[model samples]
Every structure is written in C-alpha cells, then in structure tokens.
Target chain A: MLNPVIEMVDLTKKYRSFTAVDCLNLTVGKGEIFGLLGPNGAGKSTAILMMLGLTEPTSGMVSVCGINSTRNPIEVKRKVGYLPEEVGFYDNPTGMENLLYTARLNSIPESEAKKRAEELIERVGMAEAKHKKTGKYSRGMRQRLGLADVLIKKPEVIILDEPTSGIDPQGVRDFLQLIVSLKQEQGLTILFSSHNLHQVQQVCDRVGIFVKGKLQSVGDIESLSKQLFTESLCLIEAGIHEFPAENTDTKPVRKLLEPINGIAKIEHKKGVFEIECTSDLSATIAQTIVNAGYGLNFLNKKEYGLDEIYNRYFEGGIQHG
Target chain B: MKEGYNMVKKKVSEDTTGNQKKVKRPAKEKPKHPFWVIVNKEVSDHVRSWRFIILVALIALTCLGSMYTALNNMGDALKSSKTGELFFFLKLFTVSDNTLPPFFVFISFLGPLLGISLGFDTINSEQNRGTLSRVMAQPIYRDYILNAKFTASMIVISVLFFALGFLVMGLGLIAVGIPPTAEEFLRVIFFIVLSIFYVALWLNLSILFSVRIRQAATSALAGISVWLFFSIFFNMIVDLIAKGLAPSSFAPEYVIVKFQKMILNLMRISPAQLYSEATTTLLMPSVRSTGPLTMEQVAGAIPSPLPLGQSLLVVWPQVTGLIAVTILLFALAYVAFMRKEIRSS
Candidate 1:
C-alpha cells in the first residue's frame, strides 16, 4: 500500500482559550479525494492552514509527502498547492501576471512556468480572460484565476478551502469536474473543504465531518450514511385506505409495485402515507403496500441526498471522539 | 476478523517504520535569482503608483513656485548692485550655501512632506492584502523582507533628492552662467544625506505605526499627525516656554540670544528640527546671529558656519540617533508581523 501523502498527527492549534483545531489526526493517501465538511467556525480552514504550516500547531505534528511541515515548511510547500477562499490578488496586475508571479514563488522555471500557466488557464477555462486586469475581473473569474495559479505548480497535494463558493451552479460543476480530472489524471491528493455538501458528496471518496472545532466523524460516504443516517423513506399513494389488517380479510386489489424491506413508521396525510424504514427495506415495503392496496397511485423510495446528510451532523449535535 | 485486525496493525507498523527511515529529498536545484528581480518589483510597484507620481509632481511645483517668487523679489534687489543679484540667486537656489541662512526655511517646509510620502503605507498595505504572509512563506530569510523594504524606500528617496539637486543646479547654471564649484557639489551631497535621514525618520515612524495599527489609512493619518505636530506646533510651544522662563535682565539682545539657545535646545527634541538646523548650517557660512541679537550679545553666541564635513559632524549625533530610532521601529514591525496569525480565508 502507498504511504499517506499528507498526515496530521494529533495536531492542535490554540489561540488563547479558543482551540481552533483540536488534536486533529488525519491522513490523505497518495491519490484520494478527501472532503472536510463543516459549517462556519468548524475549524476546517484552521486544519488546512496547520497542515500547510502557515499556522504553527500548539502541539503535535503535520507532514506533507513524509516531510515534517513545521520544521521544513518551505520544502513541504513545494509539494502542496493551496487556494485560499476569498483570494486576494495584486489588483493592479493582469491575470497572467498573477499566475506568472505565483509560478515564480513556487520556484517553477520561467519557460516551464509560462507553458504550465497557459495550460492551467486553458484547463480551468480562463484562457480568454487571462489578459484582463485582475481588478476588472468578477469574483467568479478571479476564483478561476486563483485556481489556475495553484494548478501552475502541479503540486502533489492540493488544499482548497471552499473551491466552489460564490460561483454559479455551472461554474461549480465545471470546477468540480476539473478537480476530479486532476485527481484522476495526475494521482493528486486533494484535501478540500466546502459548504457545498452535494459537491463534496459527489466527488469525495471519504469525508471528515467537523463541528465546533472538532472532528465529528471520519469515514467513507456509505458507512457514514449507514451509521449516522439509516432512516429510509418511501412515498406511497393509494386509491383505497382499506388493507388486510383493517378490512377483515378483504385485501384491496393493487398492481404496479416496487420492492422494499423493513418499514419503521407510516404517516397518512392527504390520501398519501409516507413510509420510513431502515436501509434496504424501502423497496420491499413499497411492493407490499402496492400489491395489497386497491390502486397504487404512487410508490417511490425517497433518497436523502447530501443536503440531508450534512444537516444530520450539523443539526444533530454530534460530538467528536 | 481477528486476522484482519492483525493485518491492519502490521500495515500501520510498516508505515511507521517506513517513516522512521525517512530519506531527505535532495534540495531542488534552482538558479540564483538576481537581486534585481526584487529591486525591479519594488521600484516598479512604487514608481508606477499614482500616489508617488502625484506627490513628486505636486512637491516639485510647490517648491519651485515658492523659490521662483523668492528669486524674483531678490532680482529686484539685484537691479541696484551686481553683488546683490549674484547673492540673491545663490541664496535662492543653493539652499545649503546661502549666507543669509535660508536652508532652515526650505527644509522645514519640505522635510515632512518628503518623509510621510516615502513611508506612509509601506507595511500596512502588504499586511492588508495578505501578501506579507505569502512572501514570508518562501525560503528567504526574514531580514531580507525588512531590508528590501528599507532599501527600496532609500533608493526612491535618493532618486528624488538627487534629482532635485540636479534640477536646482541646472537652474543655477542657467542663471549664473557657471556650474557649481566642487565644494558646492560637496555641500549638496551633505544636504541630500540629511534629507534621506529626514525621510528615513518618517519611514520608521510609519513602519512602526503600520504594525500597531491594522489599517493603512490609520497609519498614514498617524504619520501625518506626527509631521504636523513637529513642523507646525513645536515652535509655538518653544516660544511659550521661553516667554515663561525669561530672565530679569530683559535686554532684547541678551533676551534674543537666550531665546535662540532655548529654541535650538527645544528643537533638538524633534528630529525634524534637528534636520532643518543641519540644512541651515550646511548652506550658510556666516549665520553669526541665530536670533535678533546684537553683535555684543552674540559675541560668542553664534559660530561661523562650518564646512560641509563639520556640519555633518555637528549633526552626526542627531543623524545617528534618528537612524537608531528607525532601526528600532523596523525591529518592532518585524516582530509584530512575524507573530501575527495568518488564517486562510
């Protein structure tokens, strides 16, 4: 197995009594897309910053590609690409100029840096806007340019905070696709935090959920879904309310059935009863209802996407171990 | 399940052991970037700024306007005598070489403006834009950042001072039909050095202020406030103090001499005052009466204006003091900046 490319071992950061990042132990394998999900003040940013060695950890350690980050930050930086949320540019410079300067900072050779910059700008869909002065660029365009600048280095680890924030839906999709492609094509390890839960869900292989400066849970999407949220739901509509138990051995004739398993609860309102059950029971339960009832008007299993999963942690007040 | 757990433990150990044999990657081979890359960046950023260009142009116009007026009036005096015209233009153009001691008036008027313009936003803007953190994140030494800023400001101040020197010299040449003597050149150089120090004092103040105040606007305002107090209100306080402490003799000559001495001593407390005095002494060779004093009262009160070297020696303590103060301020800025927490946005 490949060694983890990024590691934070019991990393803690404290500012006075406020613990920004509390004993975070995280690892990113050589080619994993790891999402750090949290709301505001969850210390997602603080964790990434400590990992970058931009902020010193009060105690513990961070390493990038096996190099101790704190003791050798510049060396670690060489292998990392960072895109800060709300990125600021030398406003007077053009987009190309900003990219070139960042390339220089990363110690990329001038000729190679220029070529790489062009390629990144093209890849990030900023090729047409590259010549415009940064001050004149809109926020979305500036973000694209920022991403392009980070990609100019082709770093082994890419750490981005809210890479999709403030962007239109189309732009978000495009940016996520670009990140996915980078990971797939280059074997880049990504450690990105975003408020966009759906985007994280679609791309990330594993996620670390944070709340109130602590990691609430860390696992693959399926496990987190099963462990944290197992309430399967179904929407069913019936022509008659009579069933075998209610109608004295007279079952309402029905057809057009789908399968379900275990039904946990049923709520009837406006002639439609919503069924909630454990995982793998929705299809079996739905089929049972439709075959027994007179007319199955609607029978569909409900899939709670990332928005619900995100709220389960944020609103449920889960604590970190 | 037990076997899987054991396998996981073995993998963890293998990883930890692999970490133990950590091999240091060879430092990437990078060519030496010439010092000029940084210098060019600094110079281009500053010189291209609208603030710098507007400031230089406005100052030049103001100084030249006043000096032209002064010379025109002096030209009237020249109509009566050849000696008067020559003396008039010399006093007007060569501020540091005037017999009548006009250097104080010129420098006191110009020094603060030059100083504030050179340093008002040097550190604050970088901090606000978050570039300071990015620049420091590189492998370069900490001192390089501070020294580079100081050097860039110094270069700019040097360029402005010497450029003014050339402008005045050219005008003098056209008016007098003779270029400056070598001694005159030496005097100008001394004056320029004092001017640089004067600017450095402001830069130092601004840098310190920038660190203390998070906002660039606040730093600039604070710098201007310091300049205003020193240049405008300092002398008024000196006069009030002198009036309150007058001796019983009440002789105007003796009183004036005593007053002049008190004024000089009070001005010594302010760097701007020390700089203006230095410029005056460098320019004037016969400022025997520093105040409205009779010859008898000032019998030994005033010394003959010393040569350029002695004038420098005279002000060397003040210059050294200001430089020390500047370094101290810069050190404080460095410490403050280094300790600041740079959070990702």
Candidate 2:
C-alpha cells in the first residue's frame, strides 16, 4: 500500500460564526494531479492555505510528506511549494533576482541557486524576460515566472490556488500543459483549485467538487458521473415532419418506444421527439422510431461531462435545502 | 485510465529513487541561517532604494551646512582666546554661531525623520504588495522578518551617522589646525552611538504602528503625529498640568520643588527630551546637572567642567530610559506581527 503525499484529516476553518471549510478530508497520492473544483467563495483557497500551514485550522490536522503541518510548519514548508492566486513578487527586482531571493530563502547555495534559476527560467519559457523587472511583465509572463519560483526549491508537492483564474483561453491551455508536464517529468504531486470544471477535466486525474465549504463529491470524472446519474444516460433526438393531426400529439412515438426495457422517458417539442435511455440504447431506440414510420432525421447521444455533473449536484444541493 | 495508472506508477518509482540521492547531497551542506539571509536581502533593498538616497543626501547637505558655520566661528574663537584644548573635536560638533544651531541639535531634531521614513512602510507595504504571505511561507520563523528589518535599518543608520561624524572631524582638523584630545574624541564617539539609539526608538515606534495599521500612509501619519506631539507640544502640556496642580506663588519652597520635579519627570517621558538632555550633557561639559541647584549647594563648587565619567552619570538614566522604551515598542510590534493572520488580504 502506498501512502498519500498530502493528507487532510477532518480539516476545518472558521471565521467568527461562518465556517469557511467544514471537516475536509482529502488525500493526494504521490505523482497525482488532483483538481479541487469549486465556485468562488467555496473554501478552495482557505483549504490550500491550511494545507501549506499558512493559516491555523480551527480544528483537525493537515500533513504534507508525512509531517504534521501545524506542529512542524517549517519542515513541511521546506518540502512544499505554493503558488498563490495572483502571485506577486518584488516589483523592483528583475525576474532572476526575485527567483534568487526565493532560492536563498530556501537556503540554497548562491552558485547553485543561480544555476537552478537559470534552468527553471528556460524551462518555464521565460528566458527572454529573465532580466526585465517583474513589474513590467504581463500577467501571462508573471504566471510563468511564478511557476519557476515554485520549482526553484525542487519541492515534492506543489499547491496552486486558482493558477489560471485571469489568464486568456490560449494561455490557460498552455499553462495547463506546462503543469501536466511538470507532474510527468519531475514527478511532483500537484493539487490545484479552480472554478472551471471543463479545464479541470482536461488535466486532473481526480477532482473534488466543493459546494458551500463541503466536499459534495470526490472521484474521477467517470466515477462521479456514475455516482450522480446511477446509470449512464443516452439521449436520442428524432425529427417528425408530420404530426398525427394534432399539435400536442406524441402518441405514435410514445407507443413505439414505451415498451423498451431501458427507455426512461420521452419528450416531444416543436417537431422533434427526444428519447432518454440507458447506455447503448440510443441505437436501438432510433431503429424503433424509424420502424414506427416516423422520419428519424438525426440521432445523438450526450454523455455526461463534468459541467453537467456539477450542475446536477449543485442544483440538487440547493433544492434539498 | 489504465495507461494513466501505468505512467503514474513509473513516475513514482523514479521519483523515490531520485529523491533519496538528492536528499543525501543537500544534507552534507549546512544551510545558512534564516537571520543572515533576511538581513542580506533587506540591506540590499534599502541601500538601493530611492528613499534612502534622498534622505541620506538631505542629512549630508544639512550637516555640512551646519558644520561650515561652526568651523567659521571656531576659527574666530581660536584667533581671539586660544582656548581650544578642552573639546577641540567636540567643538566641531557642538560649536555654532548666531547663524545656526549646533550639529548635535540638528541631529537630535531630524534623526526621528530618518527613522520614521525608513520604518513607516516596512511591514505594511509588504502586506499590501502581497509579499508577506509568500515570504512567511518560507522555512523561517515568523519573528525573523521583523527582527531582520530592524537590524538592517539600524545598520544603515549607524553607518550614515558615523560617516558624517568622521567627515566633520576631518574637515575641522584641516580648518582649525588642531587635533582633539583623547577625552574629546571619546565624547564624540559616544554621542554618535547615543544618537543611533535615539533614532532607533522612533524606528521601533513606527514599526509598531505599521503592524497595527493596515495602510502604510496611515502608519506614516501616525508616526509623524507622535513625533510632532513630543517635539513641539508635550512640554507645554506638561507645564500647564504642573501649574494647575500647584498654582499659588506664595506656596512653600518644598511644594515648589516637588512640583518642579514632577514637571521634569513628565518631560522625560518624551524621547526627544531624553535625547536632547543626554546630548547636551555629553557635548557641553560645563552643564553639570539637569535640575535647579540651591544657592548653598552651588556656593562651594568651582567653575570647572565635569569629567567624562560624571557627565555619563548625569545622563545615564535618560540613556537607559530611551533604551527601555525602544525595547518595549519593538516587543509590542513583534507580538502583534507574530499573531496576525497571514491570509487576511
């Protein structure tokens, strides 16, 4: 059995009467990219702060690399690298100077620090802007420099809070690719938080959906969809050029598809009939609709993506309360 | 999914093997202490800043202007009386004509400005720029940042004052053609050290405000307000209070004496009063005491200046009071900073 590199055991944080994080128990295995997906004000940032020991939890424990973070933060800090949301550096110093200062703070030797900074600068694709003042750099450039800043200490676990919040679409794609490469090439365990479900699905091995400071669901995308829907759903859309002499009549298609074992429901609107059923049933239903002498103009099966799964869970939560 | 699992397994094995070797190598090289690292970075940042340059230049220009005036008067005195042996070097710092106050007075007045300017933004600016959290995330204790900031700024202040002192001494030697005696040289050195401590008190106060106030501008304003109250209005307020307590002129001599003592103790609460009294005793040896002396006590005394040891005794309490206040302010700032929430943006 392999041990998790980063673990939170019933971690909780509260400010006055408001609980920001409520008994969060998370485990990130070695060499895993875990995306913490939630909307704004959902305790993602607070949880990251607690994990890095930058904030004292109201209760519970957080351990990084097997060291209790609250009890021994300095030891944990040495092994963990954190890139805060909208990370800022000393504006007056050049990018190289900023990285060198961070390296020195981590107690790396001067010569070695310089070499590592240069290597990281090139790796993050900021070699051209290494000598420029960080204040003059663009948001994308600053984010790249921030990535290099986190890697200078060669941390085993990296924590990023909303790393792609304000970046452009292309830059977000490029940045996510860079993060994936870092995990693969350097074998760093990464835990990043974001509100963008689609982006998280692109790079994360597993994701935890947070709602109102609670972990509503936690698993890979496929497993989460299974847990939410119980059975995979497929939708069949068929066009009807002619109705049965009535605008509200869906009887002909209903009569043909009602007896199918996995067909759950059928909805008719404006000349198109939609049929919902279990997996691989869309083809059989489409054949049935055509066999009943209706014009099957088009058929499509919609698999559940993270966006739909998130909406279902979040909406369910709202309606329940 | 199976492919991803296989890739992750391979990477983890590679990492464990590589981490073992890399960890062994770093263990051999002892890490530098966090104190020195913070000190080095802060020193470089302060020295290269435009604020330090402008402040140092202002002090230098004013000091030279006062020194020039003192030198002209000393030349005239040397020609007339030829009595420059007592504190020839000390005269360069303390002697002034009607054109200006002496160098000691100028420093005691403007020294707080240097301190407040250096420290008003030390912690708050870091917090506003969002660098405090990042720096605190490093492998260092929380208090190291505050302590290093004070130490680095103090080092800069000492260097500036010592350099200016030496420059004045060298110029005086060339202009007046007289070297200071051993006692005079020691007195000048002691004055410089005392001036550093006095300015450090203001620096610590400003840092305390910086920790308490969220905005750098507000902290700077608060620091200056304290300086202004002490420098300008505190003595007047103390006088009013003493008079209100003992208003009758026909009161007994003992009553008057007690009220006067109360007034003097009240004034000593201000660092400006303490610094000015200490420096006056050090630079002007003829001033034997700070309080009023009775006629009987003064009748038997000779009209000679006190020695360096006795002058030190006269000002020892003031010196210690300044130090105590400085430490108290610094301790308050340290506790406030250590307990502050790092994520409160």
Candidate 3:
C-alpha cells in the first residue's frame, strides 16, 4: 500500500485471560476504504479502538496517520475521526448543535466550525432534520448525523464501527454511497468494522475477516478468493474435444492428465476430463495436457461470493454471528 | 480548591474584586480553553434540565421563605441589640422562626440534593446515550469529561449560591433599611464560598458513583443512599457508639471530657456535621468555638463577636476538611473515569 495512513503491526489486546485482538497486522492506504469483517465479539471493535488510541493494546503497536496511537493518542485523534458502533449524542441538543459541539472539541474556529457543520449536515442529507433534537431522531438518522459529526473535524482518516448495522436497506445504500463519495471526492481514508458481510462487500476496497481475535484473510474479493480457494480447489476440468482424436475412450485423457501434481483421482467422459486434486494444480494440468499433443480446452477455478468465502474460513463463527 | 483548572483558565480579566464579572466573562469569549465546548454544552444542559430547574426553584423558595421570617424578626433583634452586636445584616441569615430554618440552614439541607441531581447521572447517562466513547475519542484527555462536568456543575453552584446570597442581602437592605458592614459582607461571601465546597463534596461523590455504576438510576440511588447515610443516620450511629463506650459517672471529669471530645470527633465524620458547624461559626460570628473549650482557653476571652479572621481560624479545620474531601472525591472520580473501559452501555 502506498502511503499507508493506518497500520497495525502485531497488535494484541487481552482482557485478563481472554484475548480480544491477537496479533493483528494490517495496513490501510491513503484514500482507501478498508472493512473489518467479523462476527460479534470477534475483536474488530477492539482493533478499531486501539487504532484510534481509545483502548491501549496489551502488546504491539497501532499507528494512525504515522503517529503511534499508543504513544501520542491525542495527536492521532486530531487527524483521525472515529464513529463507534452505537453512535450517541446528547439527547437534548439538536443534530445541528451536536455537530457544532464536535467541531468545537476539535478546536475548529467558530465561523469555520459553523460553516463546516452546515455543509456536512446538507451533504449527509440531514439538512431537513438538523433542527430536531437528536433524542427524537430515528436510529438511521443518528447514524447519518454521526457521519456528519465525524466529518466536522476535517479528518484525514475516518474510522467507523458498524456504520450501517441498524438502518433500513435504502438508508444503508445511501449511507454507504456517501462514505464512498467522501473518500473519492475529498481524498479521505476510511476504515470501518462490521459484522455484516454484505455491507462490507458492498463498499470496501479491501477487507480483512476476523474470527475469534485472529485475521483469517485480508484482500479484495478476487485476491481473497485466490488466497482462500487455492488450498481447497479439489476439482479441475480440462476439455480436449477441439482436436480430432481417433480414440474415443476415457483412458487417453486420464493418462495424459494423471501425471500432474496434487491430483488425487481422475475421471473422464467424452471431451472433458475431471481431475481431482489435493491442492491447486490447474496450471500444471493445463501445461501437461497441452504438451502431450491434445488441444487444451478451458481451465476452471471456482468463482466465490463473500458468503461462500465467509462460510469457508468462518465456519466455526458463522452460526454465532 | 484546585482553582486554576486548565479548561476554564480564565485569562479573560484580572479584576478579582468583581465575582460576577469573572464568572460571566470567559463564556462570552472565543473558546481558548480546550473542551470549552463541552463545558459550555454541559452548563447549558444543566441549566435547561428540568431536574436542575426544580432543585433551584426549591432552594429559592425555601431561602426566600426563611429570609422573610428573618426579616420579620429583625425588629426585635434590633431593639435588644448589645454593644458588640454590629452585624445587623448578618442576622437575616442566622435568625430563624419556629416554622422555618435560617437561610444558611436551608442551603445546607438542599445543597446536597442539588449537587446530586446535577451529577448523579453525569457519566452513566452519557454512557447509556452512547456518547462517552465518541467524546473520549476526541483530541482531549479522558479526564476532560469528568473534569468538565465537575467544572460546569461547580460554576452553576457558585453562580446560584452567589446569586441567592446577593438576593437575600438586597432584600434585607430594602426591608431593614441598613447596609452590611464590610466585615459582615466578607463573612457572607465567605459563607457562600463555604457552601460551594459543601455542595461540591456532594457533587464529586455523585460523579464518583456515576463513573463506577453502569446504570443512571442505580448511580443516582447510590449517591442518595450515601447522602442519607451521612446526613440523618450518622448522628444516631455516633450516639449509639457513645452510649456503648461512655466513661462512667465515677470516672474523672477530664476523662469524661476526653470521652465526650472523642464522640464529637466521631460525629464530625459526617459532612453535614462539619458544614453546620462551619456555617454556625461563620454566619453567627458569636460562636466562640466548635468543640468543648476548657476554662484555661476561655479564661481571658471577652463575650464579643469574633472578627472574620478569628471566626475563620475557629472553623479552619472544617473548611480545610471540606476542601480536602471535595478534592479527594474529585481525584477518585478522575482516576476511576480514566481507567474505566470505554464501552457504550
């Protein structure tokens, strides 16, 4: 990642005997949206807190914007905006007032804070409801105001914990769309943690799956599938019907493909031969079949959705989540 | 009295003579103090809260009613005034009728309720609202939340007590047709300062409970229970202990006095006891001592009202104790809040 804005190297946090985040090592580059996907109590929130310098790690280090959060949390806080999983506001204050108060906490000048607050309120689609007390706001409205609240500080990196958990489907779509625009138009790096896989899949440029305090995989969809599916890829299909062959028997193709690496069993019918491999051997199988004087047809590697990927690596935590 | 807090560090104006000006000035300026936004927001919250409004109205009605009775009795006190009874204005605070307590007595009673009402849910309600972590994630110290709540509450207390004190004095001036002497004025200001410390003790106690308890109602209950334990039950407990370990009638008089002093010291453990003693000494001025004084100490003393300095000397331990206990409670709350896990509800 170029100019990584958020980095956690070997980060660990333990509460007495139970480890919350174990050896978390990840980097989020500038202007990137990194989603931390996990089940509840899977330590995603803990890692986010440590990244924001809100919770001290039991071991290792977390740095935000190149400032070691553990050593100088205040400096990190000045540049990083964190929206907790359950965003809260003072009940009596209007949404407008709440955003202004956050602006003040960040030491924004009075006029500047007001201007930024008004702009953000409008940008987050909260202009009509900004005058209403936050106590009367719906959960989704509060989440939107929470977005505006984090932006009032003009932060370089925005860390959101479950930004779309309790919203309706349409609201979630709008909120996720706003987050992407905020990153693209303003060049803000965004890191959000979510237990919902669909939300993570929709907006994240890259993702890390957390299971029981450990990161199982971290990459974009294709790369993550590549990392996860390469090991368990048991079936390989090679078609050889294009080239005319006098022999119409299965023994010829099976004999050609059986010598490939990681092949456990072979079955042949018509022009397609199925090779069962203990590990990924698609490349070697294609090369051997083509080199043995048979026209190599097509290679198959299973395309996976996040659900299948989630179920594959997070089988133990799936039901609980 | 940790006076120069970082957030409210008022470099607004250096005129120490005017209390109201100092109180009202910093709030109008550009927020130079970090988290002045929080202090300002919290102050407005307390002012707008119905709970705070009700408590202030209660204190106001009771103080005004007591002051009215004190006004009615001022004629008799004036006619029977002695040679050294120079504080005619001070009499309005201490002179009580059969039906009502004096002005100071009413304050001591309701001040704790006011403090607890403002602070019992200071931390827990914010946690329940899910704002604690969001605020703590800002570029400020964790102690800022607790300290700012405390500072704002203390500001309200000081403003209310001062306003009430000046209001009563202004009414007394209109009715009694006499202004307070300089000494009496200083004594009344000192009394208001003392009441701030008293209410501050309760405020810090309630904040401590808020930091430790997860539920707002539970923390409020815990604060009230402690107040009840100290105010009503403490004297009874001390009496029971005294009766259990009383020196016999056959014992030496010095031994009996020593035993009585021990019991008195035990009774002083309650904050109300210390506040009342300090109030009586400072407001009455004729109160020579707070404890049993031997003949030798009282041998050459004249039967006259002590000056403000001597009265302060008399209650120095109580005032210091109030300040000390208030700071100690604040420190305890600060440490608890800083170390607390930043979980939202």
Each model's DockQ score: 0.14, 0.38, 0.53
Candidate 3: tens digits of C-alpha lDDT, residues B1-345: 457664355554444448778676566546446657678888998899899889889999999999999988877777777844588789999887578989888888888998898899999888888899899878998878888889999999999999999999998899888889999999999999999999999999999999999988999999899888887888889989999999899999799889989998998888888999999999888899999988888999997889999999999999988899999999999999888888783
Q: For residues A60-93, what per-residue lDDT tens digits would candidate 1 score against the true structure?
A: 9989899998888778777787887776677788
| Ranked by TM-score, top first | 2, 3, 1
**TM-score of each model, in listed order:** 0.82, 0.90, 0.85
Q: Give the least accurate 10-residue stretch of model 1 chain B, judged by summed lDDT.
A: B23-32
| DockQ-derived CAPRI band for the predicted complex in model 2 | acceptable
Question: Which regions of candidate 3 are displaced past 4 Å?
Answer: A231-302, A316-321, B1-32, B78-85
Best by TM-score: 2
| B-chain TM-score of model 3 | 0.89
> Which model scores highest in DockQ?
3
Q: What is the alpha-carbon interface RMSD for each candidate?
A: 3.6, 2.0, 1.7
The positional error of residue A274 in candidate 3, measured at the CA in angstroms, is 14
